[model samples]
Each structure stands twice: as structure tokens, then as C-alpha cells.
Target: MSFVLLVTLTVIEIVLLVLVLAIMVTMVTRQLRSIAANLARVAFGVRAVETQVSAIGPGVTEVNRLLRDINGTLPRVAQRAEQLAR
Candidate 1:
């Protein structure tokens, strides 16, 4: 009788452990899907930022070129102004 009772209890414990593991697997799968979706959204956002930066690149280069041209002319203009004053 004691042996029968021990066997029954052991079977029940195994069944419960299996149920717990199934539940844990289901929960982990759900969380992984959510994490994947979030990562995809982040990837999309990063791509958008990259596109905007690319679009700005030529405009920024043009502005820098203009600034360099103006910087090159400033000393000549100042020298002319001083000559006029003299």
C-alpha cells in the first residue's frame, strides 16, 4: 500500500511539472514575439533617421562651401576698405 501511494504521488508531481513547463514555454514565446516586433520598429526608426541625414548631407556640404568662399574673400575686402580709407 505504501508503495502504491508513493507511485501515485510521483506521477502527479511529474504531470504538474510538465504543465508548469508548458506554461513557461508559452509565456516565453509570447514575450519573444513582442520583443521581435519592438526591434523591428526600432530598425524602421533608425532607417528613417538615416534617410533624413542623407537628405541633409548635400545641403550641409553646400553651406560649408559657401562659408569657405566667404571666408576667403573677407581679408581682401578688409584690405580694400583700408585702402579706400587711406
Candidate 2:
């Protein structure tokens, strides 16, 4: 009788362990799905930012070229000012 009781308890323990493992796996799967959804949102935002930056690139280059032209004329303007002062 004691042997039979021991066997029954062992089977119950195994069944409980299996249930615990299944619950843990389910929780992990839910968290992974949540992470995947958030990552997709982040990717979309990054693409939008990239598009805005690309649109600005040509304007920035034009501004830089204009500034360079202004800088080239400054030295001659300074020389003319010195001559006038004399």
C-alpha cells in the first residue's frame, strides 16, 4: 500500500511541473510579441525622420554655397575699407 501511494505522489509532482513550465512559456511568448510591436513602431518613426532629413539636404547645401561666396568677397571688402580710411 505504501508503494502505491508513493507512485501516485510522484506522478502528481511530474504533472505539476509540466503545468508550471507551460505557464512560463506562455508568459514569455506574450512579452516577445509586445516587444516586436514596439520595435515596428520605432522603425516607422525612423523612416519618417529619414525622409525629412533627405528633403533638407539640398537646401542645406545651397545655403553652404551662398555662405562660401559671401566669405570670398569679405577680404576684398575689407581692403576697400582700408583704402577709404587712408
Name the lDDT of candidate 2. Answer: 0.98
On a 0 to 100 scale, what is the lDDT of residue 81 in model 1? 100
Per-residue lDDT tens digits of candidate 1, residues 65-85?
A: 999999999999999999999
The lDDT values for all models are: 0.98, 0.98
| Top candidate, metric TM-score | 2
- List ranges where model 1 is wrong by over 4 Å: 62-86
Model 2 lDDT per residue over 1-86, tens place:
69999999999999999999999999999999999999999999999999989989989999999999999999999999999999
Error of 2 at 59 (Å): 2.8
- lDDT at position 77, candidate 1: 99
Window of ten residues with lowest summed lDDT in model 2: 51-60
